[model samples]
Target: MKLRFGTGAILLLAGLMLSQPVLTQAQRQRPPEYREIMQAGRMEDPLAKIKAFEEIKQKYPNSVMMNSIDYLLVSAKIETKNSIDEVVKLQKDILAKSTGPGLITDYLTVNDQILRHKKADSFNKQKLVETIKKNAATGKKNANDAKILDSVPQQYRKRYLALSSTFDIQLATAYILAKNSVQAGRYLATFAKEGGTKDGEYFFRLGQVAELNGQKQKAFNNFFRAAGLEYKGADTKAKALYKKLHGNIKGFKEMLEKKLTELPFEPKHFTPKTKWQEKTALVELFTGSECPPCIGADLGFDGLMETFSNKYLIVLEYHLPIPRPDPMMNPATKRRADYYGAQSTPTTLFDGVNKLGGGGGKGNAESKYNEYAAEVERIIEKAPQVKLNVTAKLANDVVTATWSANKKLPNTEYHFVLVQKQEKYSGGNGLKLHKMVVRDFTTLDTPMKKTVLFNLSQSEKAAEKYLHDFEDQRGFKFDTIHNKIDRAHLKVVFFTQNKNTKEVLNAVICDVKK
Candidate 1:
């Protein structure tokens, strides 16, 4: 990300990197004396930048930079992954001196990063969680008061409200990351009790906590509840546990499914929109047919597609090699999984940024679907700064594609892919239909051209490979299974993403010629 720019270019770039419209006028101004130090502070290497800052501190103890040096020092320490205890002390010092309660969010963000460190256990988890609660409370109060809310700028106001809404979940997760599962459970329970989180994912988490605490009955109850809630991984694990504890619950799973279905699944709010790709959303589904935990993804994604077809949502279900093999599973699936850090079945990504769906069970399937739907609805409304002009055509076995932009794109990379609208693969779990299946990938450096060999028709080798994926997972419900690829069911999915940030800019589903 480093570029060698001249003096004028560097000055222009600095404006894009640092801004403080929310701060007071005086705080926003950079003193002339700190110019060289500021430039050195912007070095790419954290340790080298820290050395530059330290040099400034030693050279001018009485300088004006003294006032702001602490913040810079702390930022550097975090950038260098300094000791958690020392960083905690420095961050707390910054918080104590912070005149604005909302600024506590900066410290919380640093602490959250520190908490992510595997060996970072120096700070008290309880104390840190409490501080987040206090900040969240203050943020709520400030956001609710007309005068106080008006005093803050719009961007900071939005940030404060967002942090307030998310602090509890972040704090609970931070505790778990710090290896303080006991405190993590306590905070998560308190969060749920306070009506802070309602996603069925919380129930799966509670089950995990119960298991960690050796509360078998409580754990089983939570896991069992999660199974019917529209989470495949949780349901899979719950079913396994249920069978082990009380062999063949007969109609137990069926009864749970029936009851869940009987419940009214009404979304509180959703407005159907016509326009989709001003900002398109991608659902990267990590699943395998052999993995029973992926059933929820199958059902839930079906619901999503029903709600928003190729118009607003583009689905890519990657079959993985886990627990057992899936014939359609390929190296690309594993590569993408590794890139996304997906280690378990039923993991999904929204726009390659927000991750959702995993674990053994879902506490509420209908509710989870609504949550996902709401996100898509929100994305569908966003107006994009750049629009993608992408097209794909298939001829023989080779596919050619072109991607261009109306204007300069906002940090984007071009990706061309092949997708199947439907494929039939009945593995151990006996799934009959797999949709939005990603078949192949090709990368493009610009909005120019890229081509990849596409499998227009299924080969016997493909069927043989498919059979090999499930040779050991014996007794699939179907006595005879056919593995074939249908070209008529295929299309090309194109993606434009922030090359550095990994954010999807736009996605298109283009029909392929028969």
Candidate 2:
């Protein structure tokens, strides 16, 4: 998709360029000249495209689309210029002006292009790798800045993460090409310790590192796993390595087939201690089924469930119609969103206050999972200050929840939620199954031991009314109706929180038995 800048953005760009003092008269006009930019992008011939883009760059020197223009111009030049030096110079110019994800992307592009140029001597390769590494460090620094990441639109976060992942793998390959085996192995070890990418290329690189370190058995195992993934020439390398290690390649193909059916490689991470925690951590995810960015957050939540037991963690997903209409949205879900003051999809709150916003696409799921896993571990280690428990039963379309707490502090509120264990819906975001969806909820100003009965039949009508009101208020259309309740698969959640501080004191989840 093409990124267009408005008058304000162009003016901001102009302000940032004022110190350059080399702006053309046309650039000083500060006009929105996106049409010319799009025209350049659509040019058929490479030379023509390069000329058009160069002209656009000269005319709209302060355009926010300067990055896009430079990238396109470089791409066109790659097709027309036979000199590797000129291509390298163009990429270097882009790298100089780029920051954040753009810098990382351009670095990856430059490094990959350099690698593909077989004519490049070792000295040139070393120089290029050094430049790329220096710029990659800068990109990482900029990306680590909270303000920079928050400035990015949530939907674009996925693309940024994917680019960063590719940059990381490419950086490792660059070190290996430079014959810095020590650095490559060190980098791969650190990445693995932090839960590295799940791609087969990672394992292939690990195999190379193992072979370099003289661990032939380990190298064979790594190559076998990489070959199982069928990544590029890993199968041939795995066969050759197996023949050298075991004196035969007879069982190599069989091993590869068996490994193919197994789960992908997962690096080991420190598991958090959960034996003595007094209260389980509560993680609430606010998401939209039609929102593309929520895919990573949704999958990350599923990973959290697999990684931690319910005795240590309890999770709830609240649906909202954000960026697009979602079928899973309802009144209670909207109310929960308001309670947390959540304004964006894929926003996750840990214990009510530690809010992590922005998620990416499916390719970014593993990164997001690692991020959440780290936070959950940190939060789980906190000493418990309150004790809460809850139980519930489902019978004749009625849910009875009994609750008790050690004590309730001032400005504290108790919340009871009915969660559907799982729901199936073919949503716009391509998610087929949604878990732990909030079907209904209620809040009380004070806490007390009592039995609350919820009639599913009445709640269903209320859900319909809520949907109708939401449609009228927002003037939005929903693609499908999803108010139906599945009583057979449901759970009840009880949580208490400080209304003023928004810290969840305690929480518990119980199955709704019929």
Candidate 3:
């Protein structure tokens, strides 16, 4: 329960097994052990699943299920709330016998594990250098291969490489920790060139590396870029660094003012132009915890929610690996992000048509609130077509949830999404307590307006697993969730989308009380 950073989370494999051959009735039924293993394969209580995997392994170490069960065990071990040394030993044992994607991914994670608990010994430094080299070589090969990845399967397209800063930042840190200044300088320079001028953190870090390497010109340029971004801390850091490196900082600040006018992102035209003004609006907020620019963007969105949510709005925050790994990273969220062409953190997709990128304008927080407030006011000016209501009740291990639509929708698809209102996991930027997180979702394709029932078992963990690519960074684990959900902050969101256009029509929220 005390797992910090990326602990106590494992990959859910239920959906992944679907890509293989179809299972017969008997094969599907299998045995009690298979059923038990599948039940514990989610994120609610990883310790329980870890124990289940251990039981299965002890009884049937040589069973035909060893390959599949071994994977589950490895993933569960990563998520187990145990000591770090114990984790290192277990990972080393798995690495000795594992093969294919599992082995490679485990190796990458294990390398980080070693780094996480590294000592001052020269031997530890050598091990870290070796691991860093291995992760880079393997990651590069996998990045270039056109085939489907066997380990992590997040996006089908090559768009994932766009978020390379996730690993690049960690790699550069490892080199710096090892005191390999030459390698650190080289990798950071390449990161700056390939990452371009989009991410402020990348530019800021590049400036630090450049300054350390005595590349004042490169450092000044990168620092100036960071100063133009929305984050005040990064802005201040860039200003201080610029002054340190150059005697006359006043001249640079003056020029930066003019340069920011012609910034990287132009004013995008994302005005809502729906045929019918819908009162109940759904905003798919795609964000990353580590992204500094996201701080302003999130604040702008939250401002709207604080005032407008009571009137008519349902905000669904989808966490993804934009600039870093987030505990709430889900395959479904990533797919939804890709579907909407969400390339960067703090990308807000409103009602599936109005897509806005970047944080709010560079100004005070109050001004930032006004920046997105107008958009929300426009969305809720009129009532929606369907008035959806949803509710959930728990009894023992069973969760009985029901949803109803106010109007008939023969052509629209209804999706019932169960969400965790808030969590205690603070991401890279110290933004803990993530809200409106998608725990699990169900869909009814092309359905008419009617009351529907959905049942969930707390013991079943595989019902909501979505595959995603993590680059060996074992993403936030757990299933769609059954019963281990924090009852206090649990809510259900109802969304109705057009079957043909795929545009979300309307949405409603119902907070559940246990």
What clash count goes with each model?
A: 8, 0, 5
Spell out the clash pairs found in candidate 3: 8-79, 9-79, 43-478, 43-479, 154-469
State the weakest 10-residue window (summed lDDT) of model 3: 1-10
Q: Scored by CA lDDT, what does every candidate get?
A: 0.60, 0.71, 0.58
What would the per-residue lDDT of candidate 2 be over residues 1-514, giving only the tens digit for each residue?
A: 0011122122223223332335567765635877787677667787998899888888888775565566667766765655556667666665676544443344555655555444444435567577657656765565456665554556455444444444455566667666677888777776555444555577778788778778888888877766664556778888888899889888877888777544342423446665557667899999988887787788888888878878778899998988777777888988888887898898999999998876755535666778888888887787766787888987788999998887657788888998998889978776778899998898865465487778899888888888888789889776677888898888999888887999998788899998
lDDT of 2 at 383: 72
Model 3, 97-165: lDDT tens digits are: 533333333444455554444241233565556665665566445444445244334532222243233
Runs with alpha carbons beyond 4 Å of true place in candidate 2: 1-89, 99-168, 171-196, 200-277, 290-293, 357-374, 377-383, 426-430, 446-449, 461-479
Could you give candidate 1's per-residue lDDT for residues 1-514 as a string of tens digits?
A: 0111122123222222232234566745775557867787678886887888788888778755564565666566665544555556656665555434334344344445454444455556666555555555654564456664454555345433433434555566566645566876876767666544344445566676777777766776777665545434667666666676677666667856664543223334335665544666777888887786575556567677777767578889888766566767654566678877887787888888877763222223354466577777777788765666556676775555655667667567777777778877677654657887777666666554444345544333454455555564564333444344566666788777777777787777777764
Pairs of residues clashing in candidate 2: none
RMSD of each: 15.3, 8.6, 14.6
